[model samples]
Structure formats: structure tokens, C-alpha cells
Target: MEDLKVNDGIVSETLPGSPPAGLESYGFDQKDTKRLLRKMDWHIIPFMSLIYLLCFLDRTNIGNARLDHLEQDLNLHGLQYNDCLAILFPFYIAAEIPSNMMMKRTRPSIWLTFIMFFWSVSMVGQGFVTNYSGLMATRVFLGVFEGGLFPGVNFYISQWYRRDECGLRMAMFFSAATLAGAFGGILARGIAEMSGVGGRAAWSWIFILEGLLSVVVSLGAYWAIYDYPDTATFLSPKERHEVQTRLREDTGHLSTEFDFKYVRQALTDWKIYIHMLICMAGFCPIYSFALFLPTIIKGMGYTANDAQLMSVPPYVCACFFTILASYYADKYRRRGVFLMGFQIIAIVGFALLVSSGNTAVQYTGTVFAAIGIYPQIPLGMAWNSGNIGGSLKRATGIAMQVMGGNCGGIIASYVYISRDGPRFITGHSILIGFVR
Candidate 1:
């Protein structure tokens, strides 16, 4: 037992080890420590939002770029483009566990930033891709870099926030992805309108500009983010203590070293399977429509450019609903009902899109699709993160969920094709059936 002068409210307890050399060197009490920890959220949440937003932007920007001629120019016809999408998934599923393993071993901020830099570099390289093989390689590398980010962030959040607060934080971060969906249209449209700049196509500029922005923001994130409570230097010594104390209230133990055995046990757990199934079902409607949104909107009788413009509204609508649903779910400390309700709404939205003949009616259904489908991400992630007991378990569970949902990417890629373009019966119908 060693005496630690924590906050102004001095308290002495037998610490596990003799206080670090000159442990008494700094002036901090438990109360001050608690305040600093409370302040940490301000530093954390917004940056997480930025990270996911860049990821989403890079991913779906292809949708918009395709509108400007990525597919045709690159000679990606028939299943070739679809195969490129499908390629990313297997690699993503393969890389996720290792990425999370590394995240567990190193500073999450350091690892995440490194991943972002490379993914952005790949995204930038996509602009220069001359043919199918080049594009395929870029997408594969992009998937490898971005694969672990979502799960890594989930693992990082579990390290700091209490279970109760996790839902709202997760929702807010995930909402940025939805926002990217909404805003990407506008961004792509604006960039598309540029048409030609410095001898490059507008679509090329979209990739170049957005990718560079990701690199710069990631550089900033490496500096701004605090990986965990104990290592967070921005907080007062007192706040660091408070942060650790509060997390213990939920986990019963507070340590970053995850037990590998628990990770193995989590892999065999039934709950992981249920989450995987639900996520796979949920993502069918979500990503299927999302990835092909420009095409879907164009089918409604708009020009390619106008269709790109129209894609923004539904995504914006989805973003709003995501936040609302997350806030209410957290408020009541409930998950299942909110999640089911959103799934049903998503199913209804898809039904409307598939069943309707009127252009206005079909366009309206896009709004429903956005609102109904997007919120499931936060709800599902919150459910997994809340229930998992330890760092390794949480990491494995999140990685499993992400990998499982990305399998939906394969299903979605095959579901929506240019041949089925204008009236994608097979695509939206599958989405409706699965989400229902």
C-alpha cells in the first residue's frame, strides 16, 4: 500500500505497486482526476466522427465517380466492376482480425492513423488507374487499410466510455458514415461539375482531393487523439484517475491487455452468431441501395448529374434519423426494439422502392430506405460493445460483426447490376425480403 495524493481531496490507498518514482511529484487528487476524465469526451468523439467520415467518403465516392465515368473509362463492364467490389470483401474479412490484434497491441491512435494514410494513398492512386487490373488492385488495398478501422474504433470506445454512454457515442460516430452518404452526392456533383481541371477529369479530381484530405486529417488525428484513459496526457492527473475509476464500474477490471483466450471463447459464442446474422440482414438494404444510389436515382428519370444531386437528400435524412434513434435507445437503455423498428422501416422503404411506378413515389422511397436502414449500424454495434466483457472479447465481436456485414457487400454487389439498372427488381426485392 502506498499513499497517493490524487485530487485536492487527498486519499491514501495501498496501490498495487510502490508509487512510480516520484509518484508524489505531481499535484492531483481523485476529484481533479475525475474532472479531467470527464473532459476527455470533448477530445474524443468529434475525431472519431472524422475518421469514419473519411472512410465512408472514400468508399462510396466510387458510386459518384462511376456516375462521372469510372466504370466505362476503366472498361469495367458486366461482372468486372462487381468483381472488384467483391474482391475487397474477402480481403477485408481476412485482414480485420489481424488489424484488431495490432490495435490491441499498439496505440490505437497510432495504428488507425497509419491505416488511414495508406488507404488515402490507395484512394489517390485510384484516380490514376488506367485499366481494370489497376482499379482492382487499388480497391483491394483500400479494403485492407480500411477494414480494421470501424472495429478498431469500437474497441477503442469500449476502452473509455461506460456501456451506457457507448450507444450515443457509437451512433454519433456511425452517423458520420451516413452523413458521408448524404453529402457525397453533393461533393461528387460539385466535383463532377468541375468537368476538367489541370488536364484531369472531374472524377479524377474527386478522388485526388478527397484522398489528400484524408491524409491531412489523419495526420492531425494522430496528434489530437488520446488512445486510452491512462495514457491521455491532455487530461489532468486527477481526471485520468477518474476516467479509470468510472470504466471499472462497468468492466469490473480496467486494463488494455486483452486475454487471448476470451477472444477464442468469443469466436465460439452464440451471441456473435446472432449479431452476424442480424447485421448481414440489416446491411442488405442499407449498402445495396447506398452503393448504387446514383443509378437508382437516375432510373427515376433524372440525368446522371441530377441523379447525383438527388442522392444527397435521402442520406441526409438517414443521418438525422440515426442520431434520433441512438439518443432514444440510450435514453431508455434499450436496443432490441429500436433496432427491430428500424429494420421494419427499412424493409418498408425497400418495398416502396421496388413496388412503386411513379418517379416521385420511388424517389420518396429512397428517404425511407435511408431512415430505416442506416440506424441499425449504431444499434447493432452498441448491442455488441455493451455486452462484451473484456478488450479481446469486444475486439473480436466487433471484427466479427464488420466482417460478417461486409459479406453483405458481396451479396449487394451481385444484387444491383447495370443490366437490372433502371428497375432493379432482383436487387431491391432481395433487400426487402432480407430486411423484413
Candidate 2:
């Protein structure tokens, strides 16, 4: 046993014969570290990815419903449908900081599971709403419940992995959203065929079934997800100590204490604001594309089923490109170049969509846009999380970034309005401006 000394808020042990610092000093040699990370990937990544997949599907399924007469059933005219989409973000943005604070206090499993359960219930309620007000109410509550998930998961993953190791893991987690877009299209196509089942519309069945899936997954998450390194039950005592020591060496500080000072620090940090702006720029086009891709395809002269099927390829392309970009970004320790490059790709995509009258050319633009935009999300999140030192500061900073970024969803909901129809030049031009 060695003496435990506290330096700059980090508590670490001084082990004799340990290399001065880093994972090697903590007895996590390459083989052991690789094996441990593999275990974590198996245990943690899949579950977290699944949660995000469902979260995105629930949030954006309204887009799919639109193809199946959701607007008609609810009597939504003109901007009313857009209003339903826009209303979600106000409550979503308001709840993030508080929900993240609650996650810190109550533990990730409990806080996340509770939110997942409620958000799913809200999704289910969206199925039954008969009027615009009912739809608005459900959307608001859905936002409130889901507000914490992205940042909470980002912060939670930051605790378990070092900064350099986070990029691909963040990609793996975030690619689920792209996967949801792909899967949502196929699922919606199938569900649209079930229009008369139980006397409910096909669109209604989409919400009900997807929401039910979320509930079951939330229950499983309670048992599957691990907490912080110090409290994780699956690791051996030796492994836990090594893990914590490696992290302490990596960051130089890890404050689990609930302190307002850290909150103030996060709020005051210039990097936090810069990261928030980056997130906003990255997310604006993403939310718009996710919500409108099927419609955009349909406007290109595809039938409803063909449009839904067409939406899948862009998302699939996005999932592939996101992983590749994150891998190299982590390998070279260069995020800024990748971020700028991908954003440029998206700008090109939007330009193509706006300038071209040919349907194939516009559809190709969607693929470019998806691939370009999806990679930046995980890259931005990992970049921001990597810079923040303390656990408390990281939590607050991530929440702030996500909260600000989600405001883009409100902007997106309105950009491609009903009247814009086939070309939507205004929406594409607006997105291009934001990306630039």
C-alpha cells in the first residue's frame, strides 16, 4: 500500500516503481488496457447506443407520421405541424441543466432510466392525441424527459474513458442517431402498411410500438449500465483502482463533489461558449435533415414507400463516415481539421440541393449532407468533453453545449415549411448560412 495524496483536487496513490504518469504507470499495460476496453465496449457501448437510437427515433418519428396522414388526422394546417415540431425544444432546452444536475445527484442509471421511461410514455401519448394542443403537450413533455440524455451520456462516457480514447466511442454512441434515421424509415414503411390494425392509423402504430420498445429497453438499461469508476461493480478491485488512477493522471483533477464553484466556472468558461456555438452550427442542419429527409425525397418524385426507403441510404452513409472520421481524428489528435472539412462537405451538399433541378443530383446531395453533418456531432462532443477537466465542470459544460445546440431543432422545424414543397430553396439556403 502507498500513501494517498490530494493534489489540485485529484486524489492519487504514489506507487513505488510505477512509471511517473499515464496508463503505463497505473499498471494498465497495452494488453490489459486493450482487454479492459474491450470489456467496456461490450458492456457499455451497445446499451448506450441502443438508448440513443430509441431516443432519436421517438423524437423524429413525427416526420415519418407526416407521410402517413398525421397532419390530416390532427387537422394541422400550414405552420401548425411545424409548430408542433418547434414547441419541443423550449421545454427541452429548459430541462437540460437541471436534468444533468439531477443525474449527478441520483446516479446515471436511475436518472437516465427514469427520464427514458417518461419520454417513452410521452411518445406513446403522441399516438393518442386528437387535437393540436394534445400533440403540443406531449411534445413538450417528451422534450423535458429527453433533455438530459445526450449530455448525460456524453458526460458519463467521459468519466469512464480518457480524453484521447473518447472519439470513436462517442462516434459509436452517436452513430446510433444516424442508425435511427435509417431504421426509422424502414420501420415507418412497414408500420404504414398496418393502417387498420386495432382501428388506429399506421402513424399511430409507429409511435405506440416505438415508445413501447423504449420502455422495455429502459428497464434493461437499469441493470446493464455501469456507474463511475469508483463505484462500478463489474470491475475487480485492482482494475477499479487502476482505472481511477489512469483517469486521475489523464485529467489532473476529478471532482465528484457537488460544488457551485465548478458550475460557475463552467458557465464562465470561454471554451464552453465556443463549443456551444460549434454544436449549434453542427446541429441546425442535422435536425432539419433528419426531420425532412423523407419529405425531401418524396418531393423528388418518389412514392411514400420509396421516399422512406430512400431516406435510409443517406443515414447509412452517415454512420459509415462518422466512424471513419472519428477514428482518424482520434488517431492523429486533430479534431479541428476534420470538423472544418466535414462542415465544408455539408455546405457543398446544401449548395447542390439548392442549385440543382435534377432529382438524382438532389438525392446525391442528401447523401453528402448526411455523411458530412453526422460526423461533426460526436467530434464536437468529444472535443468539448476532452477539454473540460473536472467531472462537475464537464457535466455542466456538456449540458450547456447540448442545451444550446438543441435550440437548432426549433430553427430546423420551421426552415422547411409546408408551402416550400419541392425545392425548399429557402430552407437549404438558411442551412448553408448556418454551416458557414
Candidate 3:
């Protein structure tokens, strides 16, 4: 064996008279590769999914709280409620690129775990805010801490799996948010019933209980989550070597250094902007939907409690469709087609929502919207990550996409204003234009 130095913390060895890049040269056949993938899925996916689940739950449960009279209790008149929701994205956008850089330097486990802890604390703080300004402050800090998670996690996942394998893996991770949407509806229903418990409103309990759950999960993540394949302690040294070699071959190169040159390269890349536009267009509908779904349902003449329960099915349908769409996208290795197809579906759903008057039909439109919007998020992300090469470039690219995309949250917060109640034709029409 000849020792060959490579960047990115990978230790490379060349076997005598063997192909340098082939898995066979490293004593890793198809069977060994399958086992390695299964092992990684076991260790990584569930923990990351759980983290994302809580991250989404903490950020979006405000919608559920809205039904519980959060606005009335906090004295949020006019656009104050929308302002509080809109404020999260600016800080969320500002922190992402920097956060990705920090993740690269500090390592995923430590950096991610640290951010998770602070964001959880921010979530807990939201429960105690007595006024709109106080709630806005908590939202800002919550944005700051949670900003790193999506891009950081996407970059981390790309490092573990090959391009062809990433779609389903990304879907599985992104589905946690959809699952959170479904689970959040049900969880909020139960939590909302706790009104006047310990002299606090049920909405207060939502933040506190969810935040506490995140704290426990964050504590466990330090041990449960693995770092890069090269540095992962759970795998054998031989397995680590196989991981490095396979990924190097797959990506054409690996990025070890956090250099300014890659950042400059990322800035100059037009593909980055194209992907950012795709993300921006997609996220408008998503954030609008997630933050306002319960409100929309309530506007459909359902009671507060029934609105919460009714919100569950759309998210549940979205979860199933996201995974199913990702399966085909990965299997066929055709991301753009799937993305465009889903976006069209979203547009149609919005069209239905805007043009319809029947209560049942409008509700069905939400299911179509959910199915269309949610799947494209992960698919688009995986597509962007798959095309980018090098760690720093990929990191910057992913962060850029997320940063630009989240700007849609600001737009979404305003588009679905309170006055457009019972039938948010204005918001629906605006989102339809966005998707198109």
C-alpha cells in the first residue's frame, strides 16, 4: 500500500497494481457498499430528521398559536402579527452564509448542536413574551440560531451520500418538516386543550413543551450524530477509507480547505443564481402555506379546534408525496423534470383555491398545494447540491440558495394578511404567480 495525501481530512491509500478510484481496488464491492449505506442511514437520518422536525415545529407553531388568540393576548393589532412573522427571515437570511462557514470550520456535530441548543432556548423564550415587541425579539434570536440548520444539514448530507443517492436522503430529511406540520397540528390540538394550566395559555405550553423536547434532543445529538465520513468514530478505519474514496470518485474532487477562492468562485457561478431563483420561487408558497394554513382553514368556517385538526391531512399527504416523488427523482436521476412538474401542480392548486367558492373544494385545493409545494423543496435542494462541487463552494451555494429563498418568507407574511379572510383570493393569486 502506498500512502497518498489528500485534502478534506481524508486518509488515502493506493493498493499496488489496482485501479486508483474504483471501489474494487479498496476491497469494497457492491455488498460492502450497501452495508455501509445502510449503516449511515441508521445512524444519521433519524437524528437529523428529528432535529429538523423540532426546528420546523418551533418556527411554525406560531400559526397554531394564532388560532389560540395569540394576537388578542399579545395586543397585536393591524399588521403586528404579520410583522412578527416577517421579522424571522431577515436574520435567518443574514446568518446562513456565515453559519455555513462556521459549520465548515467548527465541524457539523459541535456547531449544529450548539445552534440547536440556543434555538431551543429561543423557542422557550417565546412562550413568556408579554408583548408584540417581546415576541419580535424572540423571533429574531430564533431566526439567528435556526438559520444554520437547513443549509448546514444539506451540506452535511451531501458529504455522506453520492449525488444519485442524495434525493431520497434529502427527501427523508425534508419530510420531517412536513411530518412536523402534520404532527404539529395534532400536537397543537392536544396542547391547546391545556388552557389555564399553571396559569398560562395553551399556546404558551406549545412553545415550552416543544422547546423542552428540543433541549433533550440537542443534548443527545452531541453523542448520537456523526461528523464527516473521514472523521466518524462509528465506522471502522477501512470503512472510512472506502467512504473517502467513493465520494472523491463521485464528486471528481473533495474540498478540505476553507478558502476565499471558493467563495469567490461561488459568487461568480451563474448556476448559483438560477438555483437561488428556483428556491425563492418555491419557498414563497411553502412559508405562506405553513405559517397560514391553520388560519386559512379557520377562514373556511371551521372552529379553531377543527381548523387545527383539518390542517393535519394536507401535511400528511404532502409527506407521502414528497417521499414518493423523491424516490422517482433519484431512481431516474431527473431532478429538473420533477421540480417543474411539482411546481406546476402547486400553481394549479393555487388557481383552484383562488377560483373556488365551495368549502370542500377549497380544502381539497390545500391538499393539492401541499403535495405540490413540499416535495419540490427537498428535490430542488438536492438538485442544487448535486450540481455543485467542492465543500466550500457547495456550502456557499447551498447557503446562498437558502438565504435567497427565505426572503420569500417576508413576502409570504404580507401577502396573506388578516383582512383577506374567509377567501384569501389575493394571497392565492399572488402565490400562483410566484409558482409560475
Give lDDT per model, in order.
0.79, 0.87, 0.87
The total of clashing pairs for model 1 equals 9
lDDT of 1 by residue, 141-163 (tens): 99899998888888788788766
Q: List the residue pairs that clash in candidate 2.
A: none
Q: Model 2 over residues 1-436: C-alpha lDDT tens digits?
A: 2222221111122222233334355677877987888887887889999999999999999999999999999898979999999999989998888888888888888899899999999999899989899999999999999999999999889888877778899999999999999999999999999999999999899999999999998887788778787878888898888888778877775676888898999899877788788898889899999999999999999999899999999999999999999988776666777898999999999999999989989999999999889999998887788777788888899999998799888899998987888989999999999998
Q: In candidate 3, what residue range of length 10 has the lowest lDDT sum? A: 7-16
Q: Which stretch of 10 consecutive residues in model 2 shows the poorest summed lDDT? A: 4-13
* Candidate 3 similarity to native, TM-score: 0.93
Off by over 4 Å in 1: 1-38, 254-256
TM-score of each: 0.90, 0.94, 0.93
Q: Give the local distance difference test score of model 3.
A: 0.87
Q: How accurate locally is residue 23 in candidate 3, as Cα lDDT from 0 to 100? A: 41
